[model samples]
Target: MDDVSSDKHPDRGGTRRILLAGPRSFCAGVERAIEIVERALQAHGAPVYVRKQIVHNISVVEDLAARGAVFVEELDEVPDGATVVFSAHGVSPAVREEAARRGLDVLDGTCPLVSKVHAKARRFADRGDTVVFVGHAGHEEVEGTLGEAPESMVLVETAEDVRRLTPEDAERVSYLTQTTLAVDETTEVLGALRERFPLLHEPPSEDICYATTNRQLALDAVVAESDLVLVVGSANSSNSVRLVELSQRQGTPAKLIDRAAEIRTEWLEGVRTVGLTAGASAPPALVDEVVAALGELGPVEVEERRITDETMHFELPSALRGTAGSRTSGGQS
Candidate 1:
């Protein structure tokens, strides 16, 4: 199941307790990206080549691989004219052009929010503005967005990094951010950029996706009451990593795990309440497995704390909409 519930079941009894974040796991953008791959598989058949991990979650990639989705590092590895998917992190215009040149059938799984950041960077370059893109260096999304206007854009990962920057045009400056960044940390970096360039122009709208903000906010509350926090997600997942950092910033102990087996027994020592949440790309099954593992240690009670309601949904790529009916197996549905 894509969604998870923290509600305590009547059949279960335990002194240990689990507090689940309501808005945790499988956000709309991740949902849409996963759906794109599944629908493409249904419409085009197996052996669909994905240029990268469809999303950051290993479970998702492994699951898709089990269903005949071949993961590749580059376009040349894919047979010419075969179908390929771009990851949800988005890609550079160069990569898109290259795919066209290769005569490959391409399905972009880039999140719409990420596409918006790319568009904003292009616009800033067109206006002759030096764009300061605040994000981790070498991340897929950062690489993609930077590729949009590399000559006009400078990448900064921290407040100090921003201070070291010497853009060609300080007076004509604009800023954009990666969508999956930790909200509070990104805000602080943005604050520093503002201090440096008081005339800094902001993106057309908030670049951080609503799901990232909501999950961080919900995790804030989860941290307050938890003896220890465990974020269920792959280490490579950006949003999942942020949730762990957000908890640590709150002075709470937190660990990032891909599954239940990674949960250390020593961490559970003297802990009565554990807060559990998964990244946007993480599946609810991982959360369930963690809860079951906790129960094995002792009696357990499950409780859900929903900070905000997320009713947001992204539309499928127009090319796959006709095959939407066959998309019954994976994604958030």
Candidate 2:
């Protein structure tokens, strides 16, 4: 841990300490997704219709919207022959078919990691194996992955859900997961699946994205030393919500906020030490805004707890290659 002190607050009596978790905020997939949209806007100009929010963060969505990206819930809303970009959360093949039918130009912004899960789903289905996918029921990513092999896949959000599963072929069971799930809870669910299916086949690699795991591991360390943990992310963000749940499970109070303005003064009433982190889709600037917000209340000393350094990078789509603009200011890691 390295302590970096801000200037003392002259009006405040006591100093408040903040434990900032490293590897927080925008991950590589998010960066690639956002940049894809940016490059599209630069190339195609305004009225670039996007199928959904390129990423979950409101700030990122609003920023793109301001730059003239029109977000639609489905393909029907977009006019025929217009260019469209998919969200960072992968979309189903049905959506791709719809776009193709309409003759709409398409640019896929789905995270490579998520695309990997889709491939696994197809492979498992092809092998006549039942894929028991671990994820939230309504999440965009879950919905997309489920669409890959809806007939062959079953979604389970909890260990209890696992108990209720009765695959046609019990022995031919395989598992995959959403990339942004709580590490510890997923483990518990996996344990239950193992108990039920001794021969349960696991993915060749961990399904959860490295960024999500790194953020959770980093938050776990900060939550131990924090009186209150504040996670910077949108409500719709799965990994962001999981960070708050993880903190509460560890016997610490935590809150999820999209921005500093949402931070309730009551949350800081008696909090002497604060743990701050951002979700994979959240903008890094939001985290800095939170630190400044804490400073306004009193003197704050910031310490960073870095569990591991993240250096992952995903390239832009082949179509957008070499057309990329300067990278965003805040570092992806």
Candidate 3:
């Protein structure tokens, strides 16, 4: 069975230790995304086919499915004239065209920041500038961004990847990034691009999401003293996977899990100090439950590392827009 959200369970007895990672879990984009889908479900009724997981969380996706939301990979998979909502991860113009071609009642849930990257890509392409997208290959967000200008901008997953791309006009090169990438990794990739292109224009604003940057920073602080780091996120979540990578990159042992059941005894072996964090699409309540489960394991102290605060937000599409509260920012449910 797929691991869905963890509900209330009787307190299990372990060491009774839980170390909460500050700035963990959902960012404004994801929080607002869940609200959008739930609101659409409440407002429009069943048979709402989402083009992809609204976010990367498996439990969240399953929860939405249980609530009558259907997940599909492409617009073609959706029946004609069905109500379909796009995921927070942006899609390409081609997808939109196909959705329109299929005559689906589309509600775009793409994050505003991601839309910004798309807009930048279009503008760069229009100006005859070679655009370079810095992000991991095969990620949904990267795929969407690549759709913007497949023939123009090259996808560079690393700084090393950037060096190999030989644009016809180095002086007229520009770049955009995937919103959920690690801040440090993006910086190195951008550095490499600059070194090679010498003069590449970047998007007016950074593409990495504000919540992703903040959560990673908090991990850097809290993971320093912990013997083991547990990142509470689904395997598919890009930001969650990066948190695990972030810890491991720092030479710390980290584990990524959908919930507590995946937690192993050996992960805590010789681990007196354990650090806990989650991905952007993850829910804080799940993190809380994980902490509680760990508390049963042994005596544990919880600490909140105060990192930079988040105030970023995105608006739903004009069609979905209303005089609603700004749910797109670091707004939580």
Per-candidate clash tally? 2, 0, 13
**What's the lDDT for all of these models?**
0.86, 0.90, 0.80
lDDT of 2 at 14: 73
Off by over 4 Å in 2: 1-13, 329-333
* lDDT per residue as tens, model 1, 208-297: 899888989889877877878999889889999999998888877899999799989999876777889989999877888899899899
* Candidate 2 local lDDT, 1-333, one digit each (tens): 112232322223478888999989999999999888889888889989998788889998888898899999999999999999999999999999999999999999999999999999999999999999999989999999999999999999999999999999889999999999999999999999999999999999999999999999999889877778999999999999999999999988999999899989988876778899999999898899999888898789888999988899998988889784865535432
Off by over 4 Å in 1: 1-14, 324-333
Sort by lDDT, top down from the best: 2, 1, 3
Quote each prediction's TM-score.
0.93, 0.94, 0.89
Q: What's the CA error at residue 11 for candidate 3, in Å?
A: 25
Clashing residue pairs found in predicted model 1:
14-299, 14-300
Candidate 3 C-alpha lDDT tens digits along 1-333: 111122311133333234556688887788778778777776678978999899999878888898799999888789999889889998988999998888988888888788888988989998999999888888888889889988897888877788788889889999888888888888898898888877878778778877888888889987766667899888889999999999988877899999877888877765666788889888777777777777777776676676866676666656556634423212231
Alpha carbon RMSD to native, model 1: 4.9
